[model samples]
Target: MPQKNPNPKHKSQNRAGLLRHLNTREVLAMLLKHGGLSRADLTRLTGISGPTITRTVQDLLDAKLVEEGEPSKALLGRPGKMIHLASSKAGVMALVIGQDACEISASGLDGKLQGNLDRFPMPRSYSEFLSLVSQKLKLAKPKNGVKLMGLGVSTPGLFNLLEHKISSCPSIPFLENQMLAKDLEANTGFETFLLQEMHALCLAESIFGESRNLSNFAVIDITHDFGLGVVSNGQQLQGHLGLAGNLGKLPIDKNGATLDAVATDDFFCKTIARLADSKIDIQGAINLFRGGAVDAMNEINLMIDHISTGVATVVNLFNPERIFIIGKLLDAHPDLFVNLLEATRRKSIKASFIGCTITRSKANSRLGAVSAVIGKLTTGKKFSLK
Candidate 1:
C-alpha cells in the first residue's frame, strides 16, 4: 500500500532537476506558452542556469526541435531569438479500450494522428487481450521514421495510481487489479501506461476538446457504458486508489438503479429488442426516438432522468465549468440534445448554476478505439519504472 500524503518533491532538485526533466520539447513548450523569451528568461523561470538553457536551446535548434525566430523586444539585452517545440516531430500512440474490441492510434508527440489506426476485437480472457495488444502494435508501426515515444492505454475500469495497479474494474474482467506493466513491456517491447477511460477523457478534454478553458469540468461518456471522468480546479483528482470520478455504479433512481443499469449499451439493446420485437442497431434507436415511438421515447426519457441525477450529483459536488457528453450514439443524434439538457437542468440541485455547457466529444465515436490506441502509445512508456 502507498503511504498517504507522500511528497513528490524528493526526486526534483529544488528546481533545476524539474527543468532538466522537461526535455528539449518541454523547454520549447515553456517558451511557446510564455511567448517569446530569451534563454536567460527561461533559466529564471525554470530555475536552470542560463548556460544550461543556452546549450539546450542550441541543441534544440540543431535537432530541429525548435526553429529560429526574430527576437522579441522584451529582451533588455541582445535580442536573442526565441524558440518553441516543432510540433511536427513530437508524437504518441493511443490505445482505446472497448467492451468487445480495442483500437490503436499512432499520434505525433503533439497529439496529431501519425498512422493508420487498426481495430482488434476482444477475446474472453486477459491473456487474449494481451496477445491482441502485442499483435496490434506490431501491425501498426509507421512505415515512415517517426520514433514511438510510448504507449498510452485507456480502459473502462478503475486504476490505482498510488500502487500503479488497477484496483477494481467491473467492465474489464482480465485485470485483477494487478500491475501488468512488465507483461505489457515484454509483449510490446515498450513501456505501457494504463489509465481509467474517464481520466484519458479528461486529458483529451483538457488539451484538445470542449473542456479546454474550464477549470473544473466533467466528461460523461454515454456509450456501451455510462463512464464518467472528471477534472477539478484544472487538475485531475484521482482518489487514493485512482477511482475518483467513476460514477457508473452510482444509484440514481429512487428504486436504487445504477446509471449503468439505466443507460448502458446493454440497456439500449435490450430495450430496443423488446420494443421492436427484433434486434435494433445502436444507431437505429435514435431514429426511432425521433419518430415518436412511445416505448423508445419513454426509455430515452428515463435514461435522461437517470443521467440528470448523476450529473446533478457531480455538479453539486464540484460545480464544474462545463459538462461534456460523448458517445457513438449521442453525437450522431444531436437531435436529442434539448431533451437531455432540459432533463439535466430540471433534475439538478442547482436550477441556476452558472457557466456549465453540456456538449459531446469532438473525437468521432468511430474513432474511439483509434484514440484509445494512440492514447496508450503516447503515455505508456513513461509510467514504467526504469
Candidate 2:
C-alpha cells in the first residue's frame, strides 16, 4: 500500500538524523534532572566523549531546547559554560479526567507549571467529554510564543495501546471502546498520549514526590475507587494486558469481596453511616473521626485494618523500596495512616518491612497529568509547536 525507499543514501542520512535526535534527547534529560551542567559534567555523567557532548549540546542550543546558564566558577581552570533546559521555550498540555471533574494544565519539560490550571465538570457522555476537553485545551494554551509540544491525558481506565482505545472504565463507562487519544489528536492537531490515572500518579510521585530517588515503589490510589501502580527496578510495570495494577478487582477477603468494594471512599462512607446510625458523607465522617467520636474511631480502625491487608499484600508481592498512599481518607486522618502503617508492618514479613517506607502522595491528579507529559517529552517522543 506504500512506496518503499529505494535510495540507500537517503536511508543512511535518516538514520544519522535519528541518532542525533536521540543524543540530543539524552542531553536534555540530564539537564532536566540535575538542573544545570557543564559540558565536562555531561561527558562524565553520560560517559560520552567530550567532542560528542559538544556536538550534541551545540545542536540542542541551536534548536533552542537548551540555553546557556551562568558559567561555572572553576578555581583551577577556565570556567566552562553551563547548559540547562529552556523551561520557557516550550511546554506540553495535560488533562486529568476524573469521575466528577476534569483539570487541564500546561507544563514545561522541567516540570514547572506554566499557566493557570482550568477545571470543569466532567461530561456524562463520551462525545461531550471530548468536546469539553478540546475547548479547555484551547483555553490552556501557552502565550508569548511558547511552543505547545503535545498533549497528555490521564483517565480512569485500561488504555489498550494496540487497539488505540480505552478498554474498560468502571467509573466512566462511556469511555469503553473510545479512541480517546486518537480523537484528541485529530481534534487538536497535536500528538497525544493517554495514561491510567494510577500510572500517572505513580509517575508524578517517582519524579517529584517523596519517592523521587527510590528505584522500586508502589502507589495505592484510594479515592472513590481504588487502583495500584508499581515501579520495580526503576521501571513502571504495565502488565501483559496493560492491567498490572488493577488491584481493585483482586479479591481481598475469603468471601471474594474485591478491594474496591471493601476499601474505597464509598465503602468507608457507607461503613461510617451504618456505624454512626446516621446518613453521613466522607467529609462528615472525617469530622467525626477528627473529633474522636468512638463509633467513628472504631469504623476508621476497621478501614485501616483492611487497607493494611492490601499494603501487606503489596509489600510481600513486590518488596518495593517504599509505598505511597494517595486519597482524601488517608490525607484527612494522620492517625489512621500511622495505624495503617503499623498494622501492615505487623502483617508483612520482618525482612520485607525492615527498610520499606510508606508515605502519602504529595501531588494531586492535575500535577500528575503534567508530570506524565513531561515524562514523554524527555523520552524523545516527537512533538511540535503548531
Best by lDDT: 2
What lDDT would each prediction earn against the true structure? 0.64, 0.78
- How many residue pairs clash in each candidate at the backbone level? 31, 0
Candidate 2 local lDDT, residue 261: 83
The digit string of per-residue lDDT tens for model 1 on 121-163 reads 7777888778877887767754455555556677666776777
lDDT of 1: 0.64
The per-prediction CA RMSD against the true structure, in angstroms, equals 7.1, 4.2
**Residue-wise C-alpha lDDT for candidate 2, range 28-54, written one tens digit per residue:** 777767778999999988887899999
- C-alpha TM-scores of all predictions: 0.75, 0.85
Best-matching candidate per TM-score = 2
Against the true structure, candidate 2 has what lDDT?
Answer: 0.78
